[model samples]
Target chain A: MPNINTLWRTYQNLIISAAILLFCAIGFITAVFPAVEKIQSLLSDTQQLTDDTKALTAKLTVLNALDESSLRQQLSAVISAVPTDKSLPTVFSTIEGLAAQSGVSVVSVDIEGDTALATASAAKQTPEEKMLGTRTIPFSATIEGTLDAIQHFIALAPQVRRLLRIRTFAITFPSDAKPVRISLEMDAFYQPSPTSLGKTGAAIVTLSDAEQSVISKVSQLPQVSGADMSLPPPLMGQMKPNPFAP
Target chain B: MSTSEINLLKRSGNTLRTLTDLEDKLRVIAWWSLVALLAAGIILGTAFFYLSSRSDQLQSQSAQLGRQIDAQLVKEGILTSLKQRADVAKNALDAARPWGNLFPILSMIALPTQLKSISIDESAHVRLTMILGSVDDAVTVVTNMIALSGQHTIRAPQLISFVIKADGTVQMGVSFIPTL
Candidate 1:
């Protein structure tokens, strides 16, 4: 057996080579691996940021191109058709206006379901209505006139700005010489304003061709109701930090 | 005391030379590996920092544009509302019964007999009461409705009631679904 000095002399080069390899492995594990991992993470984050920037740019471009006045005008027409709330006064006014135009005399108007505005939440949906996902105010009206006037009124009901769908109508002709009495059951549609806007990252969708045509059609509808439906400006004010204290 | 140790066996000349060559090669390989690892670390560090700064710039730009959009939040709300309501209005217009078409048909049907009373609904179902002067008029009414049904103008004609009055006038009540 060799002594320690002899063994060390023989294995010195091999030991130095092994030590270098160990040093490289340690450096790779401690420094290189973490750096590589961080690079990969940063790359992913940068890619996400690039995507967000593109979306925001596109959205800004579209918004800049939009004509606020035109949007407001088109929106006004559409809102007149399907109001955001139950504008009962407009509904009655439209009916009366139609009656006057058709040369018919309005007899009575009755609202169906719960008439109290406070109980709006209690309005129940039928199975069929639930499928349509529509909210409606159902009402019935009676008018008396000549046969021609009655027919004219029926034809004009759905063509006005205050949109009404006639569910059923009955015309009664008296035996003697008298005017015809027409009773109509109808529905007026409304929807509540959206509670929240889309997220900032969401794509802004423009009006589709079909929607454009709808706006065009409604624009041609006679503004019989003439209800003011301008959306109020957003209320902006800061609240006190301690309302109770105040 | 002896300071040096002695080798126990003599090494073969060829084997010792070969071992010396291999050891040299291993030393070269180790040094090069270290250099390559260091270069890789520097390159990765540069790329990481560059990407981090780029990410920050893009994030800042996005936030700026987001603020611009937020400033027009009211317009956004109006646009959204219009989109929603326009869709509803389109559906309503499509689903509305065309009373214009029905009135012309009604006029045609009433041309033969006196249209006393009529009822119509959104589903195109129509109930009508009319006065006929004679039995011939009644036959004419039935045949006319059947012909209209054949032409896809109406469907499933039903005679609900037939009453003969003392004045020799016949009153007829009928129901059918119009194809409008």
Candidate 2:
């Protein structure tokens, strides 16, 4: 009976020692490993954020150094040539005026519908379009004039207020030395406002000198005036009385 | 001494030695276990404290950087439209091909040769068919075209053909692709 008691005591001691080791191991796993892993994850995220901040700071510094007014003026000049709206009437009038100046008589003016333009605009808004933001309208005209007048009109078409491309030029001279009948197919481009792009976050960029020169050329193109360029009046229902008005 | 007394002394000495050894072993085991438990506690506490403090510092830094980025973005908003406008303008200009500018080069080359016709395709490839008064004029046309290729405005001016007609006049054909 004494031997049995001694054996039981030894077993208890062994079990107690095992319990102490298990407790230490659990403490290391629950406290030490988790803390270390969290710290590592935090350090990685901090490093990534630091890199992003540095890049953005450098871009901001460069942008701050640029001449804001000059950039605005240049940008305005570019926008002037390619107005936000299509302004079809203005383009038509401008072409007629140019043709008249060149001594060509317009027999017929055909303006195509905006269906193709809508499709192209839709395509441009897609992700596949990437950086393309301009849309073009296609139209045709038939004019009658002398050979010299037709040639002069062709030369003056490019210098008009609205951009024009002479896609197809066909001339027919009558057998009896009558005036020449000329047919022209042209395309004009315009910009859609940035508001159509939804909410695009600010992007920083630098303009090269060559790009500035191109902007200067676009600005030098003649300006167009039409109803599309005008701003809408204040809403009649929402208008309040002006206190300062006489 | 008597034999029985000697034997009894030996037995007591052996038992006393065994008890003393057992007590020493128990003391050593207790000390080691205590030392191990204390070391583990200290290590876990130090690690947790250090890691949490460092994490707090890093989080604070990250917040500061985020605020700075937001401020910069706010400042950049004023120029966003202008930049967008300029980008569209630049793209428009890049898309245009300055085909009229090549006319002068053609005239320059045509005046020396008996130029018949010059036609340009939609892709801006120019085909020139000219009558040369002599073999020397054909050579001059070919050489001048080769030299024109050096200009940045044109690419790959190839002399397609040079043939002598029955009338002894040389007919030369040249094709050129324009780079705008």
Specify the highest-DockQ model's number. Answer: 1
Instruction: List the pairs of residues colliding in candidate 2.
Output: none
Which 10-residue window of candidate 2 chain A scores lowest in summed lDDT? A230-239
State, as a TM-score between 0 and 1, how close model 1 is to the true structure.
0.90
lDDT at B33, model 1: 82
What TM value does chain B of candidate 2 have? 0.52
DockQ, Cα level, model 1: 0.59
Each candidate: what lDDT?
0.82, 0.61
**Candidate 1 chain B: worst 10 consecutive residues by lDDT?**
B1-10
Docking class of 2: incorrect
Q: How many clashes (backbone N, Cα, C below 3 Å) per candidate? A: 0, 0
Report the lDDT tens digits of candidate 1 across residue range B48-109. Answer: 87898898899889999999987777777778878888888886776668675676777656
Instruction: Summarize candidate 1's per-residue lDDT along A181-223 as a digit string, tens digits.
Output: 9899988877666667778778887889988999999989997
Q: Each candidate's TM vs. the true structure?
A: 0.90, 0.55
